[model samples]
Target chain A: MRASVHRAVEELLSEQPAEEVTLPLIATRAGVHPTTVYRRWGSLADLLSEVASSRFSGDIVVPDTGDVREDLERWATAVATDLADPDTLAIMRAALGAGPDGGCACTADRHAQLEAILERERSRGGRTPSVEEASDGLLGPLYYRALFTQLPVTAEWVRGLVRKLLS
Target chain B: MRASVHRAVEELLSEQPAEEVTLPLIATRAGVHPTTVYRRWGSLADLLSEVASSRFSGDIVVPDTGDVREDLERWATAVATDLADPDTLAIMRAALGAGPDGGCACTADRHAQLEAILERERSRGGRTPSVEEASDGLLGPLYYRALFTQLPVTAEWVRGLVRKLLS
Candidate 1:
C-alpha cells in the first residue's frame, strides 16, 4: 500500500508541478482513501520527502573504483545527469520545501553516501576532501546551476569540478 | 505604489512564511487595490520575484576592495549573514519557486556582481578564478549549506572556501 501510494505521487508529479499535487488527488490515483495517506504520512510535504529520499537512495549509487577521483567524477556525473531531468528537479524542490528540522532526508542520505566514498579513499591511502569541501565544490554547484541558473550541467563542467577538487 | 507593494511583500514575509503570503494580502498591506496588484504584476509568483529581486539588489552590496580574495570573502560572509535571517531564506525560496524562464532576477543580479568582481581582479593583473570556478567553489556551497543542509555558514567555512579558490 505504501509503495503504491508513493508510486502514485511520482506519477502525479511527472504529470504536473509539485505545487498542484494534493493529497486527495494522490489518494484517488492510488485507489486508497485519502485518510489512509494522511494517517500514514501526515502531509504531502512529509510524503514527498519520503518518496524523494527513497528515490535518491536507489537512483544515485555511490561509485568505488579504487581511485577516489574517478569515483567522485563518476558519482558527480551521475548526479548531474539525474538532476537534469524535470521530474528529479521537481522532487528536489518538493524535498527542499519541507525543510525538516533535522535537515532533509535526501541530503542526509547523500551525505552518508559521500562519507562512505571518502572513508574508502582514506582506507586506501588517498587524500580525500572533507565532506564539506566535496559538498561545496562539487554537489552544491550542480544544484545551484540546476535550480538557480539556466546553465546546463555539461560534461566539461562536471569534469572540471572533480579535477579542481582533486587538484 | 510599486515600491510600497514590494515593501509590503517583504514586511509580510518577515511576519510569516512565503507560502501564506498572497497577492491580495500584499495589496491590503500596501494600501493598493487587489486589481491594481493583479493588473501590474499578473500573479503572486511574479510579484514575489520582483519583490525578491528588489530586496536582493539593495541587501547584498558587492565589495570592491581591489583585492579579489578579500573582496570575495567579505561578500560571501555578508551573504552568509543575510541568508542566516529567516526572511532572506524565505525570499530565496520564493524566488526559486517561480523558476523564471530567463532565470531569476536576483541570481542574475548576483552573477553580474560576481562578474564585476572578477573583471576588477583581471584588470588589476591579479589572478582570479573564473566565474564558473568561483560559483562552484564559493557561492554554490554557501547557498547549499544554507538551503539544503543543517550546516551553519560559519566564518571558518567561508574563509576556507576563499583560500581554496584562490590557491
Candidate 2:
C-alpha cells in the first residue's frame, strides 16, 4: 500500500509541477484512502520527502578509487545526471519545499557519503575539504545551473568543475 | 494603476507563496478590476515576470575597476544579499517558472552587464572565461548555495569563490 502511494506520487509529479499535486488526487491514483496516506505521511511534503529519500538511496553510488579528484568527478557526474532528469528535478523541488527537516534523512546520507570520501583523501595525504566546503564548491554550482539557468550540466562541464576544484 | 497592481502583487507574494497568488486576489488588494490586470499582463506568470524584471533592473549593480575578481565579488555579494531576502526569493521562483522568454528582459540585462565586465577584463589582457563558463563557475554556485543549502552566502564565502575562480 505504501509502495502504491509512493508510485502514484512519483507519477503525478512527473506529469505536472509539484505545486499542482494534491493529497486527494494522489489517493485516487494510488487506489488507497486519503486517510491512509494522511495517517502514514501526515502531509504531501512529508510523503514527497520520503519518496525522495527512497529514490536517492537507491540511485546514488559514491565511487572511491583512492584518487579524490576522479572519485569526486564520478560522484558529481552522477548527481548532475540525476538532477537533470525532469522526474528527479520535480522530486527535488517537492523535497526542498518540505522544510529543512523534511529532507533531513536524504541530505544526511549524502553528507555522510561525502565525508567518507573526503576522509579517504585525507588519509592519502590529499588536502580534504570540509563537507560544507565540498558542498559549496562542487554540488552548489551543479545544482544552481541545473535549477536556475536552464543550462545543461554536461559531462565536460562537470569535468571542468572537478579540475578547477582539485587545482 | 500599474504601480498599484505591482505593489499589490508584491504584498501578496510576501504574505504567501507565489503559487497561491491569484489575479483576482491581487486585483482586490490593488482595488482594481481583475480585467485590468488580465488585460495588462495576460497571466499570473507574465505579471510575475514583469515584476521580477523591474525589481532586478533597479537592484543589480555590476562593478568594474580593472580587477575581475573584485568586480565579480561585489556583484555576487549584492546578488547574495538580494537572494537572501524572502520576498526576492518568492519573486525569483515565480519568474523562473515563467520560462526563459518570460523573464527575458531581466536575464538579458544581467547577461549584458556580465559581458561588459568580462569585455573590460579582456581589454586589460586578462584571461576572460566564456559568459556561460563564468555563469556556471561563479554565479551558479553562489545562487545554488543560497537557495538550497540554508547556508548563508557570506561576504567571506563570496570572496573565497571569486579568488578560486580567478586563480
Candidate 3:
C-alpha cells in the first residue's frame, strides 16, 4: 500500500505540478482513502518532504577510485545528470520548497557522501578540501545552478568545479 | 493602497511563516477586500512572488573599490548580512518557493551586478573570471550555505570564497 501510494505520487508529480498533487488526488490514484493519507503523512508538505528525503537518502553511491579528484568529478557529474531529468528536478523543487524550514534535510545525505570521499582522500595521503569546503565549492555551485539559475549544469562544468576545488 | 498591501505582506512575513500568510489575512491587514487582492495579484502565490521579487529587485548596491576581489567580497558580505536577518530569510524562502518555476527572477538583479563588476575588472586590464564563473563560485556557494545548510554564512567564510574565486 505504501509502495503504491509512493508510486502514485511519483506518477502524479511527473505528470503535473506539485501544487496540484493534492491528498485527494493522491489517495484516489493510490486506491486509498484520503483519511489514510492524512493520518499517515499529516500534510502534503510533510508527504513531499518525506518522499524527497527518502529518495535522496543514502542512495548516492560514493565513488572510491583511489583518486579523490576523479571520484568527486564522477560523483558531481552523476548528480548533474540526475538533476537534468525533469522528474528529478520536479522532486528537488518540491523538496526545497516544502515545509516551514525549507525542507533541506536531504542535504545531509550529500554531505555524508562528501565526508566519505574526503575521508578516503585523507587516508590516501592526499591533500583535500574540508567537507565544508567541498560542499561550498562543489555541491553548492552544482545545486545553485540547477535550482536557482537557468544555466545548464553540464558534466564539463561539474568537472571544472572539482578541478577548482582541488586546485 | 499597493504600498499598504506590500507593507502588510512584509509585516506578516516578518511576524510568521510564509505558509501562514493567507490572502484573506493579507487583505484584512491591508484594509483591502479579498476580491481586490485576488483581482490584483490573482492568488496567494502570485501575491507572495510579486512581493518577494519586488523586495529583492535592484535594491542590492553592488560594491566597487577598484579591486575586483575586494569589490566581490564586500558585495557578497553585504548579501550575507542581508540574508542573516530573519525577515529577509523569510522573504527569500517565500520567493524561492513561490511560482511554478520557483520564483527566481530576482537572480537577474544579482547577475547584472556581477556582470558590472566583471566588466570593470576587464576594463582595468585585470584578468577576471567570466560572469558565469563568478556566479558558480561566489553567488552559488554564498546562497547555497545561506538557504540549504544549517551552517551560518559568516562574513569570514564569504570573504574566503572571494579569495578562492580570485586564486
TM-score of each: 0.88, 0.83, 0.89
Q: What's candidate 1's DockQ score?
A: 0.44
Which residue pairs in model 1 clash with each other?
Answer: none
Quality of candidate 2's docking, in CAPRI categories?
acceptable
Task: Compute fnat per model.
Answer: 0.38, 0.26, 0.40
Off by over 4 Å in 2: A17-19, A34-47, A94-109, B17-19, B32-46, B94-109
Tell me which residue pairs clash in candidate 2: none
User: Which consecutive 10 residues in model 3 chain B have the weakest lDDT in total?
Assistant: B97-106
lDDT of 1: 0.78
Output the number of the DockQ-best candidate: 3
Q: lDDT value for candidate 3? A: 0.79
lDDT for position B137 in model 1: 79
For A1-167, candidate 2 gives per-residue lDDT tens digits of: 98998899889988865545778899999999989888988776677778877877747788978789889988889888887787776666566544443335345566677788899898888797788778767777776666556566778988888887777
Which lDDT tens digits does candidate 3 get at residues A51-89? 777777776688889888889998888777876777876
Per-residue lDDT of A70 in model 2: 87
